[model samples]
Target: MKYLLVQEDEEGVERLWGRCAGVEGLFVDPVPPPRETLTLRGCSPEGPLSEILAEPGVSFRGLGDMCVEVWDEEEPVQWWTLVDAVVVAHQPHPGDPARYDVVIGAGVRNEESFFDVPATPRFELLAGTTVAAARAGRCSSVDGLFAPRADPDPVPLELIGCEATEPLLVGTQRPRRWAGAWADLLVLDRHGAVMASCSVDLAVSEARPSVLGYGLEDITLTDGGTDRPSPAARGIWTEWYQGPPAAPNGWAPYDAQGRTAWLELTTRAWRGRASGPDRTGGAYHLDGRFVTDVPGLHCAIAEALLGPGRYFGREWNAFKDCLSGGFGVAPPFTLTWHESDVARDALADVVEDPEGQLSYFEETVQLLERCGVTVVLR
Candidate 1:
């Protein structure tokens, strides 16, 4: 359950969440938000908003006639309409049990929270205080405003309103149901180009809070989130590590190190910004159209071409050069195109027969279509 603290500056988000050039709609159908909090121990948005006002330096906004809707597969999973509700707050999530972390100290990341959805929403400044986290170690930038000596404190965030698009949470961390959710706070120029964006992780389940600061008080209520998509817990964004985009070597697909690369690439290619459970093959807006299969299928095709040449002649080299991304070559750090003895070659599947390889590629492509993934070419 990551969060994006965006400063709304436009109308109908057709860019950041839209598709390449002429592509019309989003890949993942945006889920509508609920009229109320979905947390089992959830409280009204009022309590959190009011509590924020009492704390110095924290602020929140509200709306008159705004509606928030969250969706699942283009269908409404939750919807919330409200008059007097907190739009966004820096409060910690309810049902969040606190714990101790030897690494981060305590109290910086744990808290309770709520929000409302609306259009042209306006919230006057309840109070004014800028937040700054401690400049730990040799980093001496944040000292006074951060915290007291007995317990160093990090400054909380102040969420502002965007006048145009409906402001609300589209989706969140349902570890039992969704794979992962990416919440981006993007600074969009009028064209919706992501001039700057920040990803926040709101892995909002009942993960225990930090323990360094005792008497932090047990505020969060206990309740496993309801209506989970599945019974098993899924991965969180923070704990997972991703390699750089563009596979270093192009031979192996779904094996060795490149198996999970498709996820990061798929997210980058989706229409605008998509946050949901289906990170693999959902729907996509590519090449001015929508495709059903995931990007992993395309990754598989290029990988297949990088295999050892079947005939060991000039024709094989030429054929390899024609594939997209150049047969997914692995850079062996030398100035030459050759690979070292250790690299896991990506093209092992098609090394025996070029003709047979195409046949297999076609078969895989068609099979993907049957599985609801129709590969789209750019």
Candidate 2:
């Protein structure tokens, strides 16, 4: 039987096949690593078939009556018992030219494991030791420290206090039994202009840890709708500092259900020196605002922004742009509005659709209303 030996490291293959003392017609081919290249060749089979089958990283499949074994270093072996059946009897599907009916079946089964798995949220450090280390000299540079690395343990910044607005659903869907969450982290100066912001989506289960890192600077979290707690609101601000003046703006319209779905915004501020010689000291800020209209969605946003267990540096460029152009523009608007349909589907489906395939704008709006959040244009 003809066999295909797909392997990554040549040494791994040598270690597996080296033990085979008597095997005829055995052949070996080199395959590149998946991250880099795909290099492998056909090898003749000569040793004990069961021993080969039991090989640590080798798997066998049958092509009709012929047996094909796949070997790899990083991946476990996948055996095919009916290789000939696939090669000769399988017909290609009309819609998918590269995939045959049997191949499609196998592929489908292979993908079952990933069907409900959530994509890892992209993480970004708004500020922290990582950033401080990187920007020790450059003025234009902004640095951030992240988790799940060999870096030294992070110093926990004092939570001093936090200001949070009532939760709001930014999407247009009703509350389903299950839902995903998301949030943004914004660093702002006392004037309320954003210095840096990181947005993240949380996982389905809260068991996962999600946190956004920022430089040691004075910062505060605020809702996207700008419905921040008034400094005079007693519990919202401390006596050491006076809060910003209340906005003269009126509240947005409530949703169909009479629930005012104001965007849930949270801000956390701190004091720290900016990076550079002169070490010109300034208050560093970090803000987390929920841009999406999906309700109960802050958790997902938080995970996407801070819980990836790895540092995804500068992944917030678009977020920064939106903040700058939408909310950071003159007078420093409290909130910026955009169509929530696309954003809604991205979170519910967990797969970002560039064409807005899963958008259910009206449905999401109703969902927000059910969550006691009112949808209003800024």
Candidate 3:
């Protein structure tokens, strides 16, 4: 619950800025993707399609590229995408029992047409959305935009119950203009270990040297913004930040979103720590028991290479970057993936790729080999 605000210089010396008894809005929730309402008109879906729509709160994805292909009488029209599409309501067409009007809410459309098409198009549902699938206890991968809030607002962190040293409050007796200082806020757990951290611009609202608490005028994240964390997510974070040292696979208990949040926090906490010489040709072992999903695999990999609560990468591209060098280890290293069949089975779902659709496990193994990391599957 306590935080140490420190600034490290070029020489790696940490300068104490202040200390806070509490912090607010630190662990943010993943921003739900943008949503739009569309009416699927005059479509007579049969078999499982009707059953899927008849069910409530069931989300699904489209076919190739996970996009809904809009087709006319001759050829394909527009390929629309609904990241997480769920049926809101449906009704039979006024005159035809064979046709139905279904209104659904889904993530924003991928491609937008300038003008309306003259012909009516049909929608085909193919797969499951990452959000829905993950929530449904299915293994899913985190997309590029899945980590942060969609079209996020500016991140304003509030440091409550703060106290500063006299040297930090000398000129703040009067109402003078104060520009915020950029520093890293390290949240320490009960055992005085870093649980979470972030680089923030700290603007002092009131510098009370002796007071037990004073407010922070402004504290915003320097790196873009994020969606506000939900109450449930905040509760999950409280457990981690207030508990003892994070154990390996500690993030496995939570759902996909919660696991992703843990990875984000771990990623921030491990920033700047994965430095120094590359341990090239080192053989690291990745325990695959917890590698049920993409996010879980990332967490497991971090701990496998580094220690507990460490971070190597979040998604595939970042992993590729890490493989290049400077992330604890270099390429040409042998990674013996223990229990590799766990991931191979769990991540069997095919995902969208630049070349085409590929299973998550296949893509990951291919990426590791392509990046010069000798992947020894066990």
Task: Give me the candidate number with maximum TM-score.
Answer: 3
Q: Tell me the tens digit of each residue's lDDT in model 2 across 142-176.
A: 11111122322211111111221222111112223
**TM per candidate:** 0.20, 0.17, 0.59
Q: For candidate 3, lDDT tens digit of each residue in 249-283?
A: 77777766677777777765666353688777778
Q: What are the clash counts of all predictions, listed in order?
A: 37, 95, 3
Question: Could you tell me which 10 consecutive residues in candidate 3 have the lowest summed lDDT?
Answer: 133-142
**Regions more than 4 Å wrong, model 2:** 1-148, 153-241, 248-364, 372-378
* lDDT score for residue 133 of model 3: 21
Compared with the true structure, the alpha-carbon lDDT of candidate 3 equals 0.60
Ten-residue stretch with the least lDDT total in model 2: 130-139
TM-score of 1: 0.20
lDDT string, candidate 1, 71-144, tens digits:
23333233233323343333443344231110111112111224322222221111111110110111111111
Local distance difference test values of all predictions, in order: 0.25, 0.22, 0.60
